[model samples]
Target: MDQNFSIVSLVLGASTVVQFVLALLMAVSLASWTVIFRKYFAIKSARLKTNDFEQEFWSGTSLNDLYQAAINSARQGSPLQRIFASGMREFLKLRERHLDSTTLVDGSRRAMRAAFQREMDAIEANLSFLASVASVSPYVGLFGTVWGIMHAFVGLSNLQQVTLATVAPGIAEALVATAIGLFAAIPAVIAYNFFARDIDRLSIRFDSFTEEFSNILQRQVAPHPGQGAAAPSAGPSTRPMGAH
Candidate 1:
């Protein structure tokens, strides 16, 4: 153990470039792990909360009750809850104006769609950094390796005799950087892909919920008394009084 520690110290001391590369790899590893764990918990919580909310939403609960619940506990509510709240609020607003069924439904759909986009954006935040780390780490490691090798060769040029022991330590130390980079990168790439797929699935669920909510709105509006009601004109009619 002491010998290994001494070798590591030697490697770290021999090339500043290697030390920098290792430090970068360590940072990437820490960041990737943190994101992985955070996203895991976040996605898991979202899925569970979404499932619970869906059950309540479709279980004959009143829209007003659901909206209130969502507003009060919205931090714990999932994307579905927010979308439903937006749609219901818009539906009520349009209903108050005595809009026709088609217009009311259209307005509600628009609100839900906007909410869905917002939810997706939130869920996908920070994913780009993970992708960048995965893609760039290997190149960064290679740069360190190249620098270390150049340093070793420069030393070799000043030596009268070249031997295996003289060159092997530098090469081994250089390769360690590449290995560390791969260690950091591979898991990050895999986790990024996994999380991306999960988010896509959740997005699909959000879309389906929007469609189902739209259908529900259509049903609610279809039987209203204001089926084809239009807005009152802002100005007086142009026709002359009693001209008919």
Candidate 2:
């Protein structure tokens, strides 16, 4: 019994197809774990960076100063920073042309939306692979199980008598493939769900920031009651502290 029960022996005794299936599952398990770890760190870093940048953004920093800083260190800025930068750049460009306020705001909004899509694309990279692994592994394992059991029954046709010893090992080894599949799948499924939720939250936050930021820019584009064309151009220095 001890001899028959060894995992290595069971695997070794498995048919070529079953062995291939087991190996495939193992490989998928390894890849899934690798993705899970990488995604974990990536999401954590994004969240932390977003939080830090948001704090700075609402801390009464002038948009011009913040935009300058963000542009200078753009690589380190969060998604929000990128969105702001895109919108600000467009807004500034339109303002330079002395475009109508409506056109300026529309162009800025369009630029921000485009930036938002790009940032989301970057953030969600490789997530589909994780999702595919999670969704497909279970069915793959079941296929292995079916193949192994069918093979086991076929082998019994050669025997005059059947016993637990004859069937248990074959069935056990076949089930191993299923277990390995589940092993590969569960964490991937969990991580995919967790990441999806987090990403959704981040998207919402980014969208909210976009709306608020748009309003601030709108105020700048709109002329103040007392100030006419003589008022200094609404640069970063002119941003209202409370608008953020």
Candidate 3:
């Protein structure tokens, strides 16, 4: 509480090991914040783009038209768009070979699944680092605190007359390491949980889309009564993915 006992002085006066711990914690905290912000915007943009694409897709737009648009906008395509493009491309190619409904649907589903995995991997990149920081930083800081306390006690052992004033600074400086560690950990924990939930929701969305699109493909490929092989519908079908 003394004016001379500011945080800056406490950190500066900390032992070398504690100082190193603080520095490491600070660097980790900075990196975590960077990931947090980047992931936040990335996920937000994905969700928004997905909604937009879904709306367009369900607006009775033609499948061929959608596929063409997807191809033209490949660089700006969202995860959903890429998944749709992959499935549609595979379906069209296999349909040309006169494959049965099951084979057509299965091939398209596989393509979609592969695209889904790739997108999920990209979305989850660097997420493990946040998890690590959240789970391990506290222990790292604790190690520094323990080391600083031992060093303080070793210094006190040589004193002829140890007093509260002599011990307070050492203990305070040591506790700062723990504080820094918690500071680094709490945000990473919260961010990791939030990003995890968001990513899970996106995964579910992708899964649902995959199933719904597969059904549509199946319907198109399946033989109709009294009619030979049906061609792919030029316009979008009546069925939707599902309600959100």
Top-scoring candidate (lDDT): 3
The candidate with the higher TM-score, 1 or 2, is 2
> Least accurate stretch of 10 residues (summed lDDT) in model 1?
231-240
**Candidate 1 overall lDDT versus native:** 0.80
Off by over 4 Å in 2: 226-244
Clash pairs, candidate 3, are none
Q: Judged by lDDT relative to the true structure, which candidate is superior, 2 or 3?
A: 3
TM-score of 2: 0.91
Candidate 1 residues lying further than 4 Å off, grouped into runs, are 1-7, 224-244
Give the number of colliding residue pairs in candidate 2.
1
List per-candidate RMSD values in Å: 10.2, 2.6, 1.9
The alpha-carbon deviation from the true structure for residue 127 of candidate 1, after best TM-score superposition, in angstroms, is 0.8
lDDT of 2 at 163: 98
Clashes of each: 0, 1, 0
Q: How displaced is residue 219 in candidate 3, in Å?
A: 0.8
Give candidate 1's error at residue 37 in angstroms. Answer: 1.1
Query: What would the per-residue lDDT of candidate 2 be over residues 59-140, giving only the tens digit for each residue?
Result: 7677777788879878777888888899989888877887777788889989999999998888898899899999899888
lDDT of 1 by residue, 1-244 (tens): 4453354665665588788888888888899889989988888888898999887776666666787898888767878999988988888888898877899989999999999999998899888878988999898888878888888888888889999878877777777778778888888899899999999999999999898878766765566475544322111221123422
Q: What would the TM-scores of all predictions be?
A: 0.87, 0.91, 0.95
The TM-score leader among the candidates is 3
